[model samples]
Target: MTLTGVTVQGRLNLSQQHLAHGLLFRDCHFDDGVDLRGAVCEELIQFVGCELNDLHADNIIARKGFSVVDCQLRRVSFASAQITEDLRLSKSRLSHEVDHVALHGPNMVIEKSLRLDETWITGEVRIPFSHVGQDLDLRSAHLDNGAGLALDATSVIVGGQLRGDDGFTARGEIRLCWGRMSSISFRAAELHKPGGVALRADSIHVSLGCYLDQGLTASGTVRLVGAQIDGELACTASTFTSASGAAIEAERLVAKDVYLDRGFRADGVVRLVGAQLARQLTCTGGHFENPAGDALDLTGITCTGSVYLNQDPQHEQCFHAHGRVQMCGASIGESLVCSSGLFEFPGGVALDADGLNAVGDVRLNQGFRAVGRVRLSRATIGRQLDCGASSFVSTENPALDLTGLVGHGDVLLTSGFRAAGQVRMRDADVSRDVDLSTAHLEGTGTKVFDAFGLRVGGTFTFQLAQPPKAEVDVRFADVRRLNDSPSSWPTRQTSMEGLTYQSVSNIPCSGRIEILQGTKAFSLQPYRQLGKVYREASKTKEEREVLIAGLRDYRNRGKLKWPQRMWNLFLEHTVGYGYRLWRPFVIALALVVLNFPIYHTAEHHNLMESVGAKESQEHHNVKHCPTDFPCFNPLAYSIQLFIPVSNLHEVDKWVPDATRGWWSTFLLGWTWLMIIIGWLLAAALGAGLSQAVRRQ
Candidate 1:
């Protein structure tokens, strides 16, 4: 009991001091508090360089270690203390004008470790429910509870690590709420409480890693709500500044890896909603500046790996998430790499990962630049969804809301991808190929690639895209093949009625009506899907010239002037476009040899008289037939007007009498135009013999 240079006045009662031999107090000067109430100090309890004004150790029972090294305590109560070994207040200096609790340890039981290296406390350092068996080191600690709570370890139970890293300094609010730590090194801690909560570990249960890494300078709110971190919850190169709300409120955190990126800088909201990260979430060089709201809110976060908001082209470093980086129903196992990032929320919704379920690919490709509304609606991507050279900028709605997206693979907005507005993929289920070749899709509002009921397995490429100003409504999309053409889709800005693409690679059948100009009518399913892509490119006469020009523009839809569209294209090339039974019997045998030379040059009499009429009545002797009529064959009245059921007695002997009165109107207009070409060649040979008897 060496008390050198002693000056102890009152209240120095070590109530139950069973000190065998250790109690040295050098340069001692205790004016008041030194009451180790009910003390049972067995061995060492040295207060070197002591000037202890108050150190009321309530229920103290220091069996072995306790040294207030360079002591200058005004008030320090280790309440319910029972330190067995190490509890060194290294380089200690605690102040208390009126004793606002310097280091009041509640339920203290430090068996092994608890060092406050370079310690200097002003007030408030209550270690609640304390049981520090191993590490509770406060390296270079300097707590100044000016604005309240410098360090209140709520349910402190740190067996291994809880080091307020290296240069730890807390002006206020560093309360480790419900603490139960193993590893929690605040690398360069300088937690400042502005709007509250500099670092409140809510339901804290850290088994390992939880370093607020490199030069951590927190302003407010670093509350890890329901935290259960086994490893990695680092805030590398951290510089968090909370304005009002969340500057990192890990909602339901159950972490593995969750670094707020390299040179992380968050202004406000960095809330990981329902966090369950078992792996990577590295925001390469994160800089989240909340414009108005949501600057990195991982809604239902469940990241297995890769969620790096990329821009790390070897640390060119830029994940400048201005605002709204909400991962809606997040479930990313692999890639959510926001390559070359800058997803600014102008109106709102910059990177809303709607129902996002990515097993692997969701890389917002190369030069990613989303202004607003990049909603991946109903997202379910197992593989490829690389937005190649991304640059989506929403006007009002549908900037890039891939509605009901279910991509098993390839769904890239290829090469130089750029969307202005409407890119709503309605009922998407793209298993493969949806590469908008050189993408530049823009629709401002109505339709750019609305893609209703979209389902592409492969090849739905809008080859070398640069056209889309608007209007590309893939109505009921079931696309298989269609690498666009006709100037890469400009059929009046495109609207594939009920898009059912089968095949169509280049599609420019030598200006087929300038690719069917604006198709107001004649929708024979897009010329039968461009005649099945010209019959799969075998091009049987360009697939019968685009299915007979889509059957004469659907039989001259309406208002067909220009001589009724040239008499419906001469009844569609002599009716093959209709039924073609040897093309109306070879145009009714060439209209019976051109109406037998126009009824033998319009003969003035003789409808039909003698084929063998009583052997021509003995060579036209006119015996019994003279009173009736004579013969002026003209190929027997042109076979009775081109044989409309013609067992004709020379077709009732036609007469063009009266001095050829214009040959009786030119033989009555050649027997009514050969009786309407023999009833349209017997109704197009009875509809091609009932379509060849129903194809046998």
Candidate 2:
């Protein structure tokens, strides 16, 4: 049937006509095109499928049905096809250059699936306020248009993406339940219906921009896994409040610039795993509440610009970044965490752990704090293993563990480690002990190992197997050092290998004090205050005696004076007092002679009296006492007495006794002669004296 230029316009009823014809039904006035719809048509009805070509019949009603199922429509015309029943055109192949088809019906049940896949619809497709009685399944459909795709269904269900880039806008529910989309743009959209619908488009490559409005909810999960974007994606003011919850998750969402400025929230989780964002990612104020899982995880993400995740007081993370993550925030939790990522001014990092803190341990292995410095001001670790083992190298004076650390367990600084800085343990509160053995230190600067004011349970040991040869000021309080040795410490020589107890003041306490072997110079003020001062050289007995003597001398003098050499003699020794043999004897003789007076008296009496008194007494005539004392001689006395005066007492009693001895008689005769001579001599002497007085 090749009917050309034949205008049969009003309700041409040719049901089930098998024909191969060029039916030019152009500009014809028909309520519907040749109603061979339910007929078994074999050949193609060759006519451009267009209505309103003639524009005459305004109400050509084909209220039963219209079907061109599996038909090849070459050219046809029912331009303004008005119908009261359904119109079905499933699996039809129609040519281009067809327009102005207004199929007016309430329920246009196009129940079979449409195959617009790979078909390019250059113009617009609008299906508003119409009810597809069954589900409109357009799975894997492709739309290539310059403008967009619009569907304003109040409530509809599809198995796939309501997708277009000119921007999708929905008022009621645009429910693509458990479906996917390549891209979606809700620019200036008014999407508000709530069966709690979702738009899951994981691995969707979207271009330009995407904007989400408020009152738009989601229930099922959403994913943009491995999707790339080259525009600014904004979710500024949206509320995701669902019971089952939705997650806007992206495993590797590569984007240029992403912004969530102050009004974006998540009821579930937001996973940004291994995302390579090449711009700034900001999230200033939002509440993330996922008690079971992590609240916000951005692990292995590399951001080129500044990233911010600061929660306001009203909104917070219950679990907080509770997974293995790394984020360069302008303020980490509160302050800025700037390492290799871009950052601005200096601010402190605050880690609050009241709601959902990590109860497990943390291992700061190599590359842990490798980029920049970390400051832990008031942190308490339940159990932490931070062995600073040469992983950190200080370009300047790095502030490693400043403030103080409080631990219930151990903190090890093991071998092959070097801290070319001061380890300030000032005011640290620890429960167990601390060990610093086989460590190395050097340089002339003041290095401190301060553990003062610590309330510890056990002792602290610094007895290293191989310690460094350095000078350090260790100030420990109520902390004991246990060492025992006999040699001298703080000495010049190194062989004094033992322990010592040196008190700055003599304050009574327990435990010993130890200085290492190579300590060059130190002070033991008021040397007597030390418990024991030892030297390796043994002392002799003489030196001990000299030392005792000097001590005694000092004690006697009440105190030791300056110029210590006065007491230094107590340190030397000698054998004897330096003397010869007979000298002692001579001294003994002199002492005896000066001691007693009896011998001198006896000798004097024997020599003088024996030579004078005894001999004179034995002679019995008072013979020669000495010229010192005069004695009387009887015989000579008589002779001289008579010679002095002849009239010896006037007469003589010049008579001699008759019974006298011979000597006595002779003495009497001599006395008579001497009496006569004495009288004559007396007369001469008296005459001489008288002549001399006259001459005078």
Candidate 3:
């Protein structure tokens, strides 16, 4: 029977009514709450064509089917209802209730569709372990709960968010085609198959103001198909463990600030193509892996803030943000890519990728390795880049792929830059031979590539290395830049040694090479041709001098002279202690020589001896002396003999007279002391002058 617009208040038992036809509750008002508990109705149960007032049906048992499509349930309850066929609750408004619950089908089984799209349920919805045979669509449904919503199912084709206040724990395959969740979570849920979760909402807010303890975690595949968020997202203490499918696929997710504190593990591709992030997006301990495919594929994403992906020791390439992450033209605040082992974001700018740039800072931490080339070509930025302890392993490809990076401040690649910071191949096992054979390096104003400790697998080259070589280290081309004056550029710099033609097979440099002032020589022919293409100026006289000197040193030592030429090539550049020991004596000798009369006089020696004797004697002996001795009587006889010997050179008068001989000897000693002092002063001055000249 098709009933309509009628109130069935007391004992409306439809339990024995199996396979019932369409029953309607049109515009009926019940005094108390209606009870259709454990009722077996076959056909659709419609409240659509009615306005019901106070219809309370807790545990409305429907054995076969129950349809509330376009129905206005005034105050209805289906806490633990069981239905067999389709449960269509679309376009329904169940507002203003005590418990704030809309539909409760805990262990119900619906063979047909379960549509709840565009419905406004101002309560709670508990659909745990409910089995839906077909698609379960809940698209565009707003569930404002006082508590939360819990709809976890094992056998259900869910195509929406089981969203609520407290949390949403779904272990089944919840297909979020286009969903918005607030203060919810799907922690440790597994959904790695195709057609998984998609975030197409313009802005998905998971804000729990004072309830900051909650986290919205997605351990399975969380695919984002062009989603945008303008709020802060904290994935703190969350795990995204996916091995094949995208762990978190934000194709175009525009966010303000997104922090990934706990960690992200992706065994498949985690792409973020054409997304714009304004504030800081930190990936603190995220892991990205692709055992069967590419690991972290962030193809085209523009972040205006810092993005840090530091991996722990357990995972190797577990941290990778691939694709083109641009920060050049955009307004990125800061960028930091810090980790151990290999941390690659190839084809992206240091601060800007694909013309999107940062107006801030860029830091690459120690032990950071990039196998492929890092291309920041045609990208403009205003920042200080620090790649100090980083490493670029171009074994699979060219090491540093900074083809077009327009930096305003400093570009520090003090880490090892192999080859010529260009096409790193040849003797090296670079993935592919590079071709920086043609590129313009403006030496007028810009501070160029700086590679301090570069190591090459094979023969390194710097064909595209530029002038002011102090700022660059090109291992390929030639050591021609050494001849040029050191750079007066604003930044602290180092000289470039182009190692291009050094390890070339077959063709040897046949011409005579020369270097001046301890500089090294380079192959002229290959470099000359290369320089022509780069519009490099012809070799200057200073450069020629440096080259010749280097060649001569090399010929003598049977090796290329490094950092030193012929003059002091064998000696150490710094001074030592052997020279220091003789310096004092040399100064005294010089002083005496400058005053020749005093230095060669016998009187000078006698005076010196007397003074030495007086100083050496004991104080008591010098003060209280007897009349005969005038000093110590112990050495009186010896003193008398010494007095005679003091004039021993004039042996004719061999007499011991205390007054005359001692006086003469004293005078000579005084003169000798004066001469010695003069000599010491002269020697000291001479030594100082010599040292100064050498240093200059």
With candidate 1 superimposed using the best TM-score fit, by how many Å does residue 687's alpha carbon deviate from the native?
Answer: 13
Q: What is the RMSD of candidate 3?
A: 20.0
Between candidates 1 and 3, the lDDT winner: 1
Better by TM-score, candidate 3 or 1: 1
lDDT (Cα atoms) of all candidates against the true structure? 0.79, 0.36, 0.43
Model 1 lDDT tens row, 219-276: 9889999889999998877889987888889898998899888688999989989899
Q: Name model 2 segments beyond 4 Å from true.
A: 1-183, 187-197, 213-215, 311-696
Per-residue error for 518 in candidate 2, Å, reads 25
> Which has the greatest lDDT?
1
Candidate 2: tens digits of C-alpha lDDT, residues 1-696 = 444344454667654443333233433334434554333323323333333222212223344433334333323333233333333433333332323222212222233221222222222223332333223322222222222221222222222223322222332233222222223344333333233334434444545444443333344344556766655556655544334543556667777666553566666656676676766566555445454444455655555554545443354321122221233221111122211111111121212111111122323332222212223323343454244332322332231343355555544444433444334454555455544434332211343233334433344444433333333333333333332221212122222112222212222222122232123332222121222222112323322333333333343333446545433332221111111223323433443343223223322322112112334444322223444333432333343353443322312212333344564455346445544544544444444445335423
* Per-residue lDDT of candidate 3, residues 1-696 (tens digit): 556667656535444344466676655544443456656665667666444444443455554556565656554555455555667776776664534445555555556656666666665555554555555555555544432331333223232333322332333233333333322233332222233442222324323210111344443566545554546555554555554466666667666766654455444565666667777766656555554445554445567677666655543433454432333333455655555435444433222244535566555545665554554544444655555556554332234444445555554444442322332112212211222222223332222444332322222323333333324433343322221222212123422344332223221122212111112323333333333322333434423333334433444544445544432332211211112334444444454344344322332232212212344454322234323333222122222221322422221212112344665555445544643444443444454457446533
Q: Rank the candidates by lDDT, best first.
A: 1, 3, 2
lDDT for model 2, please.
0.36
Best prediction by TM-score: 1
